[model samples]
Target: MKKNFYHLVTATLLTVVLAGFSSCGEGKADQQAAASQTPSLPVISLPVKTLTGYQSYPARIEGVINAEVYAKISGYITDVAVDEGQKVRKGQVLFRLETQSLNQDAAAAKANVNAAQVEVDKLKPLVEKNIISEVQLETAKAKLKQAESAYNSIAANIGYGTIKSPVDGYVGAINLRAGSLVSPSSQTPLTTVSEIDKVYAYFAMNEKEYLNFIMAADGGVRDEKIENLPQVTLILANGEEYPQQGTIETVNSQVNENTGSVNFRAVFDNPQRLLTNGNSATLRVPKTYTDVVVVPIESTLERQGSTYVYQLDADNKATATEITVKDEINNLYIVSDGISKGDRIVAKGIQNLRGTTTIQPQETPFDSIAAPIKKSFR
Candidate 1:
């Protein structure tokens, strides 16, 4: 009985060992299949190109001429000829005040003047014949002058009741409506008129920028004949580029001591009247960097504290290439080191990749993913 039990136990052990070996083989096969099925990293080819250096800052749209129309004399407003946003020309009548009192005063003055003229006519013969005292004739002449002066004063006051536009512009908010009392000393404005045909954009830059610009001008680095800087771009509030270009018309003589910035003003021709006063915009200023290689910003990758990019090799493997970024111009980054002209650098998909990774490269057109640029260089 003991011998039979030992044989059965031996047979069970062999079968268990065989099952374990088979299971191990199957696990290895599965692992091999998974390894073979793993997808490869995608490859992208980017071209090397030269780019201009530019600086962008927030700017605002301003009308070259902004005016506030106010009442010149004290009276009740009877007529308002223009509404808000109404375009007007110079000398156009904006509002008319009640002039009944002035008119009545002028009529009374005219009656007095007529009476004085008759007295003067009657006294002229007396004075010429020496029948009346010289003092009596002088009194008549003085009365005629006083009446004429009163009539002229009333006429001038009546003219002041009609308010006219000082410039050709578009009307702004109407502070006073018809039948409202207005006066020369009133704090309320009747309305505002802004000239939009040619508008001004005002902005401020730091002292460093101001000094650099001055140095460039003085050193002949920029065109010496250019008294006013040409070609300024206007970006609208909605981040849209304005079709019209502007010129730098004025620069402040002194920089602000507290802000350390200098004020600048640019003038733009606004034929469409699209830009309004106080609308914010961005000003794109052109600058140049020397001896630098610029590449698409996407080509760079950050790892730890260092920046890198993938460079392709003959075996279709990507090696991490460390780069030193100098500055960013638009969508491109200027590299001071670690990249050269004609070197193919990966433009996208650098996040999920590493050194010595194999890839299948596909060439993409540079212009398709390139950043939007200005139509012409300044």
Candidate 2:
């Protein structure tokens, strides 16, 4: 009985020791698993940045003066003096119409004028001698004037056969060819003459944009605002910036009801003849934000139409805070409200974050967060 009791005691002690060691090992593992479950976050602080950026709008390029060339008379096109893309001057003949019928009309009218003039001379001599009534002489003189007027009218019509350019410009597409009949009432013009030495870029702005532009300009009144406007940039269709700057010329007097937009015209000097009529481009209007608050866009989150960012509090815990964005420049937002300068916020990983989420705060440079935005914004 004593031997059996000693073995039982020894076995019980060993079992208790093993159970205690196993319990300690499992407790350490539980602690380690709890530590590994916490999410890792990278963070940075928001800083006040003055961002200079542009707002782009679609633009239509055109010549300063685009004149439609038209034939004034009804006739077959006898000759074409200029081809498409040809340079022409004012009063330069561009086309010649067949004037054979008009020539005949002028000849007949001239004969009538000659016969009436002879009668007038004969009647004047007879009236001076009182050989016939004065009424007859007066009638002959009137006939002479009518015939002269008819001849002049015919001559004028003949002159209309020659179509001339109304302005100094480059010729556009010619819809009518030699031997094609053309008339003044034709809907399609003969061709277009575009003065492309200088070009006009046409763009539109809504009511809100117009107000912003008027308020942002340097002057007080509308006219002064137009005159004192800053130089604008032109982005061509090929993604190249035009070397020369452009100036705003005119704005529409009234808003277009159909489109709810107002038209704006800007002029650019084309020293290299690079800007052409009917080309598409972009107009980039620049604005400088002075001492405004800004943050990387990746740091923001949209919830139920509000923009929020993960801002760290005193405990390094991220809290979802709403922000008012004034404008979007590149991939950054100019925060008009909410986050302030020197405030800590998560630079990225907002998608993985929620309210009161703890983060491992990592210090990052302001430029490092915004370098890509500045470089690629252009």
Candidate 3:
């Protein structure tokens, strides 16, 4: 009976050992399945769309002609006829100088002229009465002519005290005021009269762009290409678009050695006289792109100065790829390299993934995924 009890206990211990092994094996299998699964991420496909890209550059707005109004004679300003920002006409008197000294000099010159005329009149009668020689009368007449010329020159100098506007336009910064001493050699101008009925927008591009203009044009000659170029738009300093459109009027033939850029001038109409000289602005040149690869701007990332996008392979593994951006539209980036049409890329949620991460792609529309997310307010 004791031998039978021992056999039964040994069989129970064996059964318990086998069950423990089975339980451990099943737990390991479940852990492996969970570890192999990768989280899914939203993705989008690159599309080929006809988009117009704009290349903008820093620009300056100037009047067609900016004329400096200067003092013509040296004297204290007695009257400032126009104020700053006032409209003026060509040849309109802008300032009056105190010309009391010039007036005194002119008065002295006029008296000399009268005395010389009296002497000439006296000599002519003497010659006619045979009381003096013809040579004497002729010498007196020459003196009279010289005196008249001197008087006229002095009178003209006195008239120069009144400064006039050189052009018909609006007045800019008036530095001189009543009782201010001015001169012909003064460094500062009395004011600037800018002819702003029309304005010129000046801008520049680098040497690479200058060559591109010659190469990308669709004409046989350079002149023909310039003529066929499209009109450009002006962005005002106030972040508003200028009412009138501008044409690319003149392009510098050679690049500027100092600046390493080529200058371009555009002209716009300012009938309302809104644009002023020395105003800052930007120039936007629209370029049309066709059959080009484009991706939403949100899909791109920048790493250490290089722009990148997470590209997916056939196996759904994400690879951090670099791309060259040609230009930008409203919400899309016109890519020049590193991506093409039908290429699948991570649309959003890239911060959570790493290089070569396996992702289950949840395909989403580009617009819906690319729209700027609005933050909710408390």
Candidate 4:
């Protein structure tokens, strides 16, 4: 009985030891798994504040003056004085047409004018002395007038043979080369001329924008009171901004039925000849409000149609903030509500981030990322 009791005790002790060891191994494995998991919070840098305003919009550059040079007379091109991309002045000779027929007609008319003058001279004395009837003198005078008219007509036609530039501009490709036949009625242009010293930027706005402008103006919103009105900037094709600023030249009186938008035209001085007609560019205009809160656009996130940003709390923890973005200024969002100027908001690494996540905040180089944001907002 004693030996049986000893064996039972030994077995019981071994079972308790194995159970405790198994529990410890499981706890250690759980700890390892927890340590290997990725952190929910992503580290990011915040945007710094600067005392500047920014506005960005899609814009296009265009030539203020675009012309299609056409032949005024029907003849073979005798001479082409300008080539493609050549600069020309107003009244500069661009091309010459075969003027042999016009020249001969002018000479013939001059001869007739001379003959008629001699006849009028002889008849004038006769009429004055009453040597011939008034009808004869009148007939001589009528013939002289007819000859003069013919001479002037032929001289004007001859002048049309030399094609002169109508404006000071750069010439495009010469469609008709020397020895090519041309005419005033031809469908093809002889060349194109464009004045690129200034350009016209055109855009369209919807009824909402149009009505807002009208209401603001009618409500006694003065231009000076508006923070960033009356001034606009443009983006070129190469993504470089045009240095010169522009103003609202004119707004079309009517809205387009098909597009449901109002046409707007703004003039920009392009001294470098960078802007051309039919080239695409962006036109950015600023719409400002009083005492509005704004946040960096990079801080905002969209989920299921809702826009939000990660705002830091007093504890340095992230709190998701829902914002009503009134407008996007440069690279920032103009928040009508939900955030203030001094709030610490995450501006980078937002794509892989979520609400309530812990973050290691890092200060981004103000010069690098801020440049694009400043440009976008301004």
Candidate 5:
């Protein structure tokens, strides 16, 4: 009995030791599993950055002056003086009409004038001798004046046959070539002359956008507002920016009922003749936020119409906090309220994060988080 009792005590003690070891192991495993659940996320303190945002719109480009070259008289084109795309000066002859018929008519009119002058000369001596009445000499003088007027009228028409450029510009497509019939009443013009030293970019904004733009400008009157407006930029069709800056020159007062938009005109100097009539581009108006608190857009979450960010506490616990976004720049948000500079927030990868989750905070530089944005924004 004593031997059995000692064995029983020994077995019980051994069993207790084994159970304590197993319990300790499980406690350590549980702690390790819990630690694994916490995610190591990149976090950054909010930064004050100057952000430039663009309001872009489709624009139609036109030269400073687009004039149509037309004929003032009916004739067949005998000679084309200028080629298409040729630069021409004002009063340069663009086309010459056939003047053979006009010249023949002018010769006949000159003969009639000579005949009238002969009759006037013969009657003058006869009237002085009283061989004919004064009425005969007066009639001959009237006929002479009439003949001269007819010749002058034909001369004017001959001059009109030569079509000249009214403005100094580059010639567009020539609709009429040699032997092509042209007339003053024709619907089509001989060609177009475009003065493209400067170009105009015409764009439109909706009523709401126009209201905001005018209200933000620092002026009471519309003209003053235009003068105070910031310079605009032109984005070419190939996704390149134009070298020259543009100024907002005119804004339409009435909104179009069909489109519900207000028209704006910006002028850009085109010294290189890069822009011309009928070209298309995009107009970019910049709105700059100076020294504002900005946050990475990826770190923001939209829930129920409110924007929120995962703000990190001193213990690295992430809490969902609402933020007021005044404007959005490239891959960043301009925070107006609910967050301040120097506040720590998750830099990125906040999609799967839940409320009040403890995270292993990894410090990330602000520029590092925003480098990609700056690189690709342009």
Candidate 6:
């Protein structure tokens, strides 16, 4: 009976060991099934869209006429007739100098002129009566003419004391005030008169950029090239775009040696007097690519200063490919080469994945993804 009990115990132990091995084998099989599952990633097909890119440069704003007002004579400023930013007409009185000294000089000159007139009248009678020699009468008349000329010169100087506006425009700054001494040789101008009905925006481009601008234009002559240039936009100091569009008017004949840049002038109409002299702004010139292949900026990866995108094949295998980017606009890169239309690419979730990773692609609409990004940028 004891022998029979030992056989039964051994059989029970053997069955328990076999069950443990079966459980371990099933657990590993489940883990392997989970690891083999493919990750689902968003993918997109390359689309052709029109994109416009802008190149910005620092710019200076000035009125069409930046006329500097200077004093023509030496005197103390007695009266400042106009204030800063006041609208003025041509020939309007701007300032008046102390004319007391000039008035005294004119009085003395007038007395001399009266004395000369009396001498000329007496000489004329003597010459007609033949009482004095004709040569003596002629000499007296010449002296009278000289005296009259001196008196007229003094009177003209008095007129110069009242300074007038040289042009019809708005006043800029009042440098010299009442009781301040001014002269023709003064380095600073009394004021600036700016014609702001139209304004000019000056900007510069490097030598290579200028050459490309001229050569890409559809004209043979310089004037025609300027005419063919697209209208540019002005970004004000506050980062707001100006209401008016500006046209390229003139280009400097020679490039600046010190800066190695060519200057360009663009004109804009200022109806509400919003622009003024010496205002700072930015000039934005646009270039458009029509029906070009573009990729979203979010899908791009920068590796060593070069842009890259993961391209997908028919078997859903990703391969990192380098693309040539011509420009960027609205959160998209204008693809010039390397990838073309109808090409499939991994849109997002590429951080963990590397070369030759097979994926289960979840197709997403390209426009739906791009539209939101474009709106945010705008």
Report the number of the highest-TM-score candidate.
2
Off by over 4 Å in 2: 1-38, 375-378
* C-alpha-based local distance difference test score of model 6: 0.89
Give the better candidate number (1 or 5) by lDDT. Answer: 5
Q: Where is the poorest 10-residue window by lDDT in model 5?
A: 369-378
lDDT of 5 by residue, 2-30 (tens): 99999999999999999999999999999
Best model per lDDT: 5
Deviation (Å) of 332 in candidate 4: 5.2
Per residue, candidate 3 scores C-alpha lDDT tens digits across 1-378 of: 999999999999999999999989999999777656776789898878776666788889889989988877899999999988899899999999988988898899899999999998888878999999999988988998888999998888788988899889999999979989999999999999999888999999999987886578678888888887778888887888888889888889998999999999999999988889999888888778888888787788988887889999999999999999887777677799998889999998887777788888999987686554221111
User: Per-model C-alpha lDDT, please?
Assistant: 0.79, 0.88, 0.85, 0.74, 0.91, 0.89
Ranked candidates, highest TM-score first:
2, 6, 5, 3, 1, 4
Task: Quote the positional error of residue 40 for candidate 4 in Å.
Answer: 7.8
What does candidate 1's lDDT look like per residue over 1-378, in tens digits? Answer: 999999999999999999999999999999888767443543445445555555666777767889988887899999999998899999999999999988999999999999999998998888889999888978998999999999999999999899999999999888998899999998878887899998888888899987766675533533452363547787677877899888877788788999999988888999999988778888866655665566666777877988898887777667899989876766666788887866665667777675677666666655545566333232
**Native-to-model Cα distance after best TM-score fit, residue 144 in candidate 5, in Å:** 5.0
- Whole-model lDDT, model 5: 0.91
Error of 3 at 304 (Å): 7.8
Better of 3 and 6 by TM-score: 6
Please identify model 3 stretches exceeding 4 Å from their true place.
1-36, 119-138, 217-221, 301-324, 337-339, 349-359, 371-378
Task: Give the per-residue lDDT digits (tens) of candidate 4, residues 1-378.
Answer: 999999999999999999999999999999877656533343334433433454444555566778888887799999999988888999999999999988899999999999999998898888889989989978988999999999998888788889999888889877889999988789999887889888888887788877676555432543332333468877766778779998877777788999898877788887777666667877776554556565656667898887898877766567788888776656666676777666776666667665586655564443344355443444
* Cα distance off (Å), candidate 6, residue 41: 1.9
Candidate 2 structure quality by residue, lDDT tens digits, 1-378: 999999999999999999999999999999888768666666776767777888778999999999998888899999999999898999999999999989999999999999999999888878889899999988999999999999999898899998999999999999989999998899999999999989999999998998888888887789989998878889888898899899999989799999999899999999777887899999987888888888888778888999998888998888899999898888888998888988888887779875688766777876687777562234
TM per prediction: 0.69, 0.87, 0.77, 0.68, 0.85, 0.87
> How many angstroms is residue 181 displaced in model 3 relative to the true structure, after the best TM-score fit?
1.2
